[model samples]
Target: MLSPSPNSIKKAFSRVALVGKYQADGMQEHLGDLAKLLGQQGCEIFIEASTAAHLSLTAYPTKKIETFAGAIDLAVVLGGDGTMLGIGRQLAGSQVPLVGINMGRLGYMTDIPIQSVQTILPQIIAGEYEADTRTLLAAVVLRNGEEINRSLALNDVVVNRSGISGMVGLAVKVNGSFMYNLRSDGLIISTPTGSTAYALSAGGPILHPRVAGILLAPIAPHSLSNRPIVLPQDIMVSIEVVDGREIIVNFDMQSQTHLQTGDTIQVRQSEKTITLLHPRAHSDYKTLREKLHWNEYPSTF
Candidate 1:
């Protein structure tokens, strides 16, 4: 639940969009139920075109992902965190809030469980929820001083060797100043929202989503002295392949592009942000403890 300030004004939502994993078991049934619930609240429901096709649902209005911009007040994503990640990137900068329903294991972003959908959705539609604004990273791949590719990531931007298996040499710079050079399997430049994802699997620290910092974690560095670093969000980070090795750059694990020697990747905080709606009782610590299985006692305790 969001604690409202004295100056805050509550806005009523009348248009909602649904995005889900196509063809997943029981997805159609869940979508049907959700549509009915939203309709009862006097809200206009829209479904993503592909999802509507998959479920053969033509009763509600349908729109393409890109075309649906500005036409929706909120988006309800049904699936795991991956589904939320995709939708978040697509709907970035649109200022449309997202509510994720957990349909997969270890759903950190998708906080609402399947069993609780009936209970939580009503509260949410009634405006009894909290809106958490999360930061996003903007990455640009530059070659010869020209922008070649640009992407927005809700998680981390990873640079690593593509085909060859050995470690690759990388040079890192922060705010146009030399930081360090290292030979490692890869590098992960992650947002606080991403700290719990790939960064954690690579032995990086878990950062609370509210923390305004960027984490730089090296993956299997050849030298033990090359450690992870956390920097303020306003700084710009540039990474270049120094060993003349071909590498790949991945954005939020959703898209990838090849990088050659001397190709530079720049990452900085995006001007855009994603608004995540959570149930009033949502707790970041409780979600972490449950998802990571932290502090669990044995039967004997």
Candidate 2:
């Protein structure tokens, strides 16, 4: 765990970034309100040029997505997990800290609720929130001995067939040793932070945020013996497309790219880490129980 430097954060913040889903539902109304509230706090607000129309305030400077990190002291992403994923990738190489305000359903990455932003923003700007370092994954797809696309994901990286009907055959290997050729709908390589997302949906275990491990889960495997496994974060994992008519990769549920046969995907823990603002009293296990409704059993107490 990284300790917070009180002196470093006590310094005044001059600029703030507002990231939102431009075309997503209800983005305009919420961003407009956030922009108004942020401006009133005497902070210079910066927004992506594409998201400009969503905000009512016109005085705030708007820059392109690539320029966002260089212009802001903090980034407040308004949307769901997808919104956070997009913003996190942009801020990956930078030291900027992100606070996500959820606007979509099942937001594990964008954990903060929209209704609480107004209440939390003040404390966040005042540096009262605790920051948690979340690891990311880097995935490179090689097709026919050539690099097709390389991307980073905060959640899990998935390789699955595009169509609805058929199952995908994925041959898994770790650090050059053969693991298994899974016959399943898909395979999920998830980080501890992503254990609750697609991995959990595929019958994987929920991992604590501080755990240094990776999850390998077979999505609806044809055989019951093929189950999810957790490995050390330091090991490298490679998934080969064994058999499928067509396959695609889902990076944090943000970007999707097609994969051809004989393609090898190299997965490893990314060097870059995302910093999240967790309120002082927030608990990961508590979140799971609340979100999953796990303790719904009737008891005579």
Best by TM-score: 1
Model 1, which residues run further than 4 Å from truth? Answer: 1-11, 298-301
TM-score of each: 0.93, 0.88
- Give the residue spans of candidate 2 off by over 4 A: 1-12, 24-26, 53-57, 104-106, 295-301
What is the lDDT of every predicted structure here?
0.88, 0.82
- The TM-score that candidate 2 achieves is 0.88
lDDT comparing candidate 2 with the true structure: 0.82
Tell me which residue pairs clash in candidate 2.
none
- After TM-score superposition, what is the CA distance of residue 251 in candidate 1 from its true location, in Å? 0.5
Candidate 1 on 42-155: residue-level lDDT in tens? 778999998999889888999888876689888999999988998999888888999999875758889999788888887898798988998999999998888899999999
RMSD of each: 4.9, 5.2
